[model samples]
Target: MRVLVVDDERGLTRALQRGLGAEGFAVDVVHDGDSALEAATSVDYDAIVLDIMLPRRNGYDVLAALRDREVWTPVLMLSAKDGEHDVADGLDLGADDYLTKPFSFVVLVARLRALVRRPTGARPAVLTAGDVTLDPSTREVTRAGSPVDLTARETSLLEYLMRHADRAVGKVELRDHVWDAPGEDLNVVEVYVGYLRRKLGRDAVVTVRGTGYRMGG
Candidate 1:
């Protein structure tokens, strides 16, 4: 999918370009807010990565302008500020998602992908993929309207995969987020995925040869 990455840090943007390109995204980058606003208004992008701090115009101003003009492309806001108000402000200004600085590349990708997978400018209460549906509020999972009882750990694993549906999430990413096991063996990831497959059907999760696994593939 086409993505616009807006940031003044050339080095970081370059790294993002290489990484996101490898993950199968067409990335176009702009350094300052004015350039970002120009490119975003001129191009039809699937998603956008907007940093809060920028030269000439700030991200909030650009975002407000986009929303005012009815540009509803999914936007993932970025900033060094981690305050709750800072995040709330971005969302209030029509940001689809937000990430603080020093964020995990994997999580950032997952967050952006989640926004892209959903309807533009909407976040559903229930996440669904084909016949499978998950309710984050109740920790409930159903396949074809039938409840699928799973352990707490299994549910956490399934939740992570479902949140990042249609993307091949790496083992390291899964382990760290789901299991909170930073140094654990990848074998654990394999075993839990196997559990999910047995309960959710073999086709529920697809195994990418060199990558880790993908749900809703």
Candidate 2:
């Protein structure tokens, strides 16, 4: 999975990247809200680790913009402020979950895993397109009843494509939606698309020529 970590505290961001990477996530870290918003806007993240206090834009503003733009990627807010109102405000602004700072990394990991396992919050925990099935709750993928093994990036990409199934999602859209901004240059989109094709099979995603890519039978 790909995760974007936004925190003004450099140490915490680095620690998160290191720890989450060790846990098998492709992690990207950024320090301020401007870069944070840019990253969030431009890349695809399985989930975002955002802080309330930030430079240029507050986490609330960033969260609002994301929702306003219809970016539904789940967000896990991390902040020093643990006041009831602060948590409520984050939730109200469309954050999927919240965690106060000085937290246990174990809890953070658990929360992230939960988010991955249930991206849509639906009870059955299954998503499908054609013969493909993704069980977010189980981190499992099956196509025509056979298992498909995907690397973290491939899984994140496939999830994004499936979430927007049948729509011609442009490379720029995929880039901004799937990969965190700073860690990616323009070519990362093509690279990961190639990765997805290899792992999921050549015809799993279709190129729309001048448009973008679409997922569906």
Candidate 3:
């Protein structure tokens, strides 16, 4: 799954980007509320981790704007203030869940999983295509009920493909969603697709010549 993390704390955002990336999530991060709003609006994130105290706009205004625009992405509001009123205000403004600062990383991940699984038209805990099955929560992939070892990037790529099983996915889309860095070469997508094909069987992912790739032939 993909997540958008909005926080002014550079340390916190970097930590989350690393931790969540290691957990097999494609994470995009922005510091201020304006960037947060722009990113959230442009991308279809499975979940959002929003900080209340922001530079340009606060989390409340961000959440209200998203709701006003009819964006239903699940949001987990984070704040240093653990007061009941603060929590209630975030929820009232349409945040799906709330977490106070200085919280446990384990607890934060658990809360995120809970929010993602709440059936907001988000992808399921497990994704399947043909004989291959992938569980996002456990970061496990199985083919014909047998375990498949994959690098973190491979897991993210396969998940993206399986989620859009119906049509072809272009290299640009894959690069944008699966990769975090800017100025990455599009050839990386081809390289990883080759890796996946070798592991999952060549017939598993078919190249569409001029287009990109599809899950099955």
On TM-score, the leading prediction is 3
lDDT of 1 at 201: 94
TM-score of each: 0.57, 0.68, 0.89
Q: Which of the predicted structures, 1 or 3, would earn the higher lDDT when compared with the native?
A: 3
For model 2, where is the 10-residue window of minimal lDDT?
175-184
Q: Is candidate 1 or candidate 3 better by TM-score?
A: 3
Q: What ranges in model 2 sit over 4 Å off?
A: 1-4, 18-48, 53-74, 81-86, 89-95, 109-124, 180-195
> Candidate 1's residue-wise lDDT over 86-112, tens digit each?
999999999999999988998887786
Q: Which pairs clash in model 1?
A: none
What is the lDDT of every predicted structure here? 0.82, 0.80, 0.88
Lowest lDDT 10-mer window, candidate 3?
114-123
Give the number of the best model, judged by lDDT: 3
lDDT of candidate 2 vs native? 0.80
- Candidate 2 per-residue lDDT, tens place, 1-217, comes to 6789999998888888878776656678888889988988887677899999999999999999999999988999988989999999999999999999899998998898788656687524576878888765455888888999876656667777786785888877676555545446758877888886776677878889898888856
Better of 2 and 3 by lDDT: 3
